[model samples]
Target: MALEAIKNQETLAVLGKKFDVSPIVISKWKLELLDKLPGIFDRTGSASDESETVDTEKLYAQIGGAESGE
Candidate 1:
């Protein structure tokens, strides 16, 4: 709703009044939404590709198998 209001050329002060929030807050929200808008339809799938799977059991076994040099 705030985004829509912004798009309609409403002043930041007016939007702030309507939403009962500071103009700075509305401005920050608008900026954040704009910054992230492109990721919503990203076709390269980079977001999912960056994730790594971890094996906790393998890690535990390695830790338990290690001998203390003391």
Candidate 2:
């Protein structure tokens, strides 16, 4: 799918016309894509960036003894 087309401010009817797909199909695609957003940050063999392993103790102390939001 074209990113430009996805970003355009077109109605579902217009988008369906341009892509030759029904609005229901387009909505399903959009929903499927949206549902994948969380995996973008999940690290357990997921699509998240960088290594999955980490030293939690060091990270905890460095940030704030188990209270830091970040």
Candidate 3:
């Protein structure tokens, strides 16, 4: 709905009705989406980056125990 509003694919009134929300709400959502869109794509400290710091040896030990029914 917010994307539609941003793209002008449909009027706020039309999108609001289709999504069962008010036009004002859709407008706010559109603005919020635009405001946060940049952060969503920022990869500096993203989950994938943090995942690289995980202790894989610890994880493998846990998995090995589980496989042996210990």
Candidate 4:
């Protein structure tokens, strides 16, 4: 709602009053929302790729250790 109000060019003080929050809080929320907007439509999909694989063998080699099955 705050985001919509901000988009409609409402003053920060008005938004704060409508939402019962401080103007600074409204501004901070607006900034955070805008900062994360691009990630909502991200198509690179790196998060899935990172979670799909775990190269434990390579990790052990890098740290000069062997995978000891205990």
Best lDDT among the predictions, by candidate number: 3
Best candidate according to TM-score: 3
Arrange candidates by lDDT, descending: 3, 1, 4, 2
lDDT of each: 0.62, 0.56, 0.73, 0.61
Is 2 or 3 the stronger prediction by TM-score? 3
- lDDT against true structure, model 2: 0.56
| Model 4: CA > 4 A from native | 43-70
Q: For residues 1-70, what per-residue lDDT tens digits would candidate 4 score against the true structure?
A: 4475559678877775676556665576678788778776775756676544868886445334311211
- Report clash pairs, candidate 2: none
How many backbone clashes are present in model 4?
0
Q: Clashes in model 4: which pairs? A: none
Native-vs-model 3 lDDT? 0.73
The reply for model 3, stretches above 4 Å from the true place, is: 46-70
Give candidate 1's total backbone clashes.
Answer: 0
The list of candidate 1 runs beyond 4 A from truth reads 43-70
Sorting all predicted structures by TM-score, with the top scorer first, yields 3, 1, 4, 2
Predicted structure 1, TM vs. truth: 0.53
In model 1, pairs of residues that clash are none
For candidate 3, lDDT tens digit of each residue in 1-70? 7899999978988886686666776687789899889977776764766644768797566445544542
| Predicted candidate 2 versus true structure: per-residue lDDT over 1-70, tens digit per residue | 3332367588656776676555555665567667775675664653454554778887445435323321
